[model samples]
Each structure stands twice: as C-alpha cells, then as structure tokens.
Target: MKEYLALFVIIAVFLYLTYTIASLPGSDGLPGNGGYISDEVWYVTSARNILHDFFKTPANSPYYTTTLDCLTNESRIVKEYVNINAVTVTGNVKCYIRRGFPYPDKEGILSYYNFEHPPLAKYVIGLMEAIHDEPLFWRIPSMVLGAATLILVFLSARRVTGNLWALAATALMIFDNTFRAMSGIAMLDIYLAFFTALLVYLHLSGRLLGVGTALGLAASVKYSGVFPLFGLAYLYGRRGVWGFVAVFLMAMSVFTLVNMPIAGQLGIQRWVHEILAAISWHTTSRPPGPIASNPLDWLCMHNSFALYTSPDIYASGTPAYLVALVYALYKRDDVSILYLSTYGGYWLVYLLGNHTLYSFYTTHFSPLAHILIARLLSDIARRK
Candidate 1:
C-alpha cells in the first residue's frame, strides 16, 4: 500500500510538471513573438512534407522532391510549393523564396529535404503534425517524452537510494530550466535525452534487450547517443559480450528502418553519401554569426546558450554538475563510478569535437547529475 501510494504521488507530480511545461506561453509552433525557432521551421516543414508524401503517394512517390526555385515567403509554403511569384535574390545565401517564408514545398510536400539529422525525430514531429497541424500539437511529443524521462529517473533513483532521494532528484530535474525549455519545444534533443535515460535504466535493471532497443532508439534520434554504448561496453564486458553484440545489431537495424524511406529511395550508396555530406557540412560550415562556446566555458557555464530571451531561458547545469562531480569522486562506488565514467566519456566527445558547443548538449549529462546528487544526499542523511 505504501509503495503504491509513493508511485502514485510520483506519477501525479510528473503529470503536473508536464502539464505546466506544455502550457507555457510559446509552446505553440509559430514564428515571431516567442514562436518556434528557425530550426523548428525546418523540422515542422520536414514532418509535414513526409506525412503528405506518405498519405498522398505512399506507394511510388519520391521520398523528397528536389528544391524548386520558388517565390514568396509565407507559412503556407510549409504545406505547398508555389512557383507563381517573382523571385528576388536578397542576400549571399541566394533566397529564391521571400523572407519569413518557410519555403520549397511543391503540392503540399516539402521541396527540399533535410538528411542532415536522423529521421526519427522528424518522423515523430511529422506524426504530431499529421494528428493536428498546430504548434502545441507539434510540441506534444517532446513534452510527453520529457515527462517519461523524469519517471525513469525517479524509478532508477529509487532503486539505488530510496523514495526520498528519488523525489529529490526528480524535483531537480523537473525544475531544470534547460530540460523544461527543451521539453516544451519541438526539438530533437529531448528525445535523445529520454532514450538515453531509458538505456541507462534498462542496463541497470539487467534487461539486455531493452537496453539494445533503447540504445537503438536513442541513436536514431541523434548520433550523440552512440557515446553511451562505450560505457555499456565497459560495464557489461566479456561476460556480456553477446548481449553487447545484440545491442549493436539492434541499433543498426533501428537506424536502417528509421531511414529506409529516404535510404531506399536514394539507394544505399547515395544514402551513405548524403549522410557523409551532412557530417561534412557540420564539420566545415560555420553559422553566419556563431553563438558558441568552448568546451571548458560551456562546462563552467561561462557562456550558456539562451533558448529564450524574454522569459530568460538559459541552459546551465554547472551547479548540479559540480555537486555531482564532487559526490562521485568522494563515493567512488559502483554506481558513482559508472555514472561518472559514462558522463566523462560523453563529455569527452563534445570536448574534442570540432562543432559548436550549444548549451542543450548538457541534456545528455542532466540525468547522470541528478542521480549522483540524489545518491550523495541520501548518503549524507544516512551518516547523520
């Protein structure tokens, strides 16, 4: 009875937090005045295009139409490509479409496709668009996934510490400005975070299959997820070598399936080429006015990325990260060691990467930080 009540309370809290996040002012997917970000325009547009293709000509339609030279910039371009307007070159990027228009859609389908990021996250956003083509609807998946992540954190912490510590960790996660802001947006990082947490929980629970599935799903959202597999390999060594192989095969299968529409249409060689192209773009391309920080500065929160300005939404996990780092070093137990090493491995990738360091990248470390903090607090209480 007590356990059931505790579970109920935790679930209730999660629901409340999710609702609060979902109800924020700019949760809707619009442009201008606390509307969707520039990246969201692409995500929502991609999703809408994919859905249109699936329903309109699922059997033989092309995965994506070529980028048509279109004129006029309006939200309507997100649904259809128009060639009836005058084209004017505005700037260096050569704007075929008017400013503020999310363009290049022909016949209610996207004119151009983004093979840069993995397709799974866009597919999710597309599903939401299919359900209800609204900003709130588009953000629903992130909200739900973010809430689910909290539940997983609570359960995992409960297993390691106790109800009190679990509650503490969960509360902190709930109030994390970065997590909350990302969850309320139509972005890919939240999905990555949720699957990463699920992978950790499944591994800790000794569910090899679940771990593989979670890992595959995580990677499908973003390539950054592959970092955790290294930690899994270290923890589950030769004794679990077969299971590790299973994880790899499962991850590859999921990756292939999620990308099948585009890959199948493009052919395997072309698909691989496009993927490499995306990687090259990231490595070489620089944002016109880059707002990025070095790894050390990002870690110290010297330069945090602002997700929102009016509402003052910035991603800063330095405080919790510092506390957790200290706790992990002091404890050095199996759980602490695992969490610390996994975090270090993930952080190292970002630290060494040549790409810009955005604040949301810290989402990968948020869950581990919460667990470490909870364990430290629980330990202190017991000693007292």
Candidate 2:
C-alpha cells in the first residue's frame, strides 16, 4: 500500500513538472512559428512528413495545411523544394525526401524525411500528428514516455534500494535539466531513455524475452541502443552461452519486426542501400559545432549544449551526479556492467569518429545514473 502511494506521488510530481515544461513560451514546434527547443525542428518535421507519407496525403490535399509534410521531393536542388519552414537544414547538411521519389505516395522507408535515423520514434510522433498535427500533440508521446521512464526508474531501483532512495532518485531525475528538457519535447532521446529503463526493469524481472524486446525498441529509436545488448548478453552468459545467443537472436528479430513497416516498402535494393547508408552516416564525423561535446566533457559537467534560451533548458549534468555513476563500478554487479557498456558505447562512438554528439544525448544515461545514485546513497545511509 505504501509503495502504491509512493508511485502515485511520483506520478503527481511528474505531472506538475511536465505541465510546467509545456507551458514555456516557445514549447511549441519551430522557432518564430511557435518557439525553438532545438531538434524539435528535425524530429517533429520528420514525424509530420512520415505521417503524410504513410497516409499518402497528396500535395493538393487540404490536409497539407497541418504543416506535416515539410519537404517535397520535386527536385534535388534546394530552390526546387517547398521546405515548409526549412526544418530540414542543419548547418550545411540537409534532410531531403530521398531517391528522387516524387514525394508522398512514391516514397519508400529510406526516402522519408530524416531517413538518417530509424523510423520507430517518428512513427510514434506521426501517429500523434494524425490526431491534430499541433506542436503539443507531437510532443505528447515524449511527455508520456518521459513520465513512464521515471516510474520505471523508481520500480527498477526499488528492487535494489530502499523505497526512499528510489523515490528520491526518481524525483531528482525529473529535476535534471537535461532529462527534463528531453522529457517535454518531441524528440527521440526520451524514447531511447524509456526503453533503456524498461530494459533494466525487465532484466531484473528475469524476463529475457522482454529484455530483448526493450533492446530492440531502444535501438529502433537510435542506433546507440545496441550498446546495452553487449552488457546484457554478458550477464545472461553467466546462465549459459545459449542465454546470451537467445537474447541476441531475439533482439535481432524484434528489431527487424519493428522496421518491417518501413522495410516492407523498401523492396530488396533500397533496403540494402539504407542499411549501408545508415551505417556510414552514424560512423562518419563532420564539421565540429558549438553544441558538440566529448564524453569527458559530459563527465565533468562542462560545456553543456544550450538547447534553448530565455526560459533556458540546458541538456547537461553536474559533476557529482556523473561521479556517483562512475563510482557504482565498485559494486561489480549486473547494473554496473550495464552502465559501463552503455556509457562506454558513447565513448567508443566518439573514438571511432562522429564528433557531433550533443549533451542532450545524456538522456540515455539518466535512468541508469539515477538508479546507481539511489543505490549509492542507500549504501552510505546504511553504513552511517
């Protein structure tokens, strides 16, 4: 009964926080049209385009007024395109409706706007856009998932730490500017964070199948989701080699299934090209920007990316929070291994190339870090 009450408290607090975030002046979609909150331009716009593509909303259709389809594949040249609000351009890089596919109906999975990233999160945003195509509507999924993420953090942490510790950690997570900022936006990292926390919850529940599914969902949001699989497989390996392999196979199957909507439309040739193109885009580095930061910078809580101004929301960390996460390695347990693999995954990507990582990406670590912090605090309290 007490636990149930605590969960209610968590929900209430998050509801208040999410509301506060949404009420910000520019919390809507693009700048000038509503306001700027960073990547909402890309993710929200891509989601709008995906909604139009999946439904074949024609160029002449009145539904296009919802501002869903941002890019029309009329021509390769920039001037020939109808760029809605120009959300697709980032520095010199441009997002296009790909393969010379003539817009909505003729589009394939790989030809959709922002096809550089996987489609699951966009599909989620697209589904919401169908309701009304408003800015807040596109962000609803992220807000709900963000709330679910905190609840998952509490539940998963409660298994290993005191209820007070779990509750406190969950509260602190929402207060975290980075996590909070991501939580209230129409962006991809919040989905990735939710799945990562769900993975931990399922892992603790000893449900290998659910763990695999969560991993697939996470990877579907961003390629970095694949990193935790290595840690999970190793932990499962302790049971047997086959446990490891089953987790891997199940995750692969789930990932393929998640992409089936897009992949089914791609045919054989475009699917192959997409696979290779995605790999190259993720691995390759381009011009350094102000928002980019290194893993070391993240740990030190230095140089956080400024996602928005005025009612400022910075995607960043404090030195102590990251230190607590690092300290958890002393536990030498499954959670520790998971944290190592997930954070190390980012470091590995940085080392291999891809210097454009933003501080907002830290959303993925918030769940694992909070759980670790709860345990650390619980241990300290007991020692005292």
Local accuracy by lDDT, each model: 0.65, 0.72
For model 1, give the 10-residue run with minimal summed lDDT. Answer: 57-66
* Per-residue lDDT of candidate 2, residues 1-384 (tens digit): 787687788778776777666656463323234543477766666666666575554222112221124434431222222433222221222233321111221123223467678888988877776665555666778788988998998998899997889988887876677888788887899999999999999998999888888998898888888889879877977888887787788888888887787677767578768877887887778676667887878887777998778867687765545765567668857777888888889888888888877887888877888888888889889999
Q: Which stretches of candidate 2 lie over 4 Å from their true place?
A: 25-36, 57-112
The TM-scores, one per candidate, come to: 0.78, 0.84
Report the Cα RMSD per candidate.
6.7, 6.8
Model 1 pairs whose backbones collide: 29-135, 73-101, 74-101, 81-105, 81-106, 104-111
Question: Going through the candidates in order, what is the number of backbone clashes in each?
Answer: 6, 0
Q: lDDT per residue, candidate 1, 298-380, as tens digits?
A: 45776777765555667765577667777878887545655566566545655455446566776766787787777888988
Candidate 1 lDDT at 334 equals 45
Error of 1 at 239 (Å): 3.1
What shift in Å separates residue 147 of candidate 1 from its native position after superposition?
1.0
lDDT of 1: 0.65
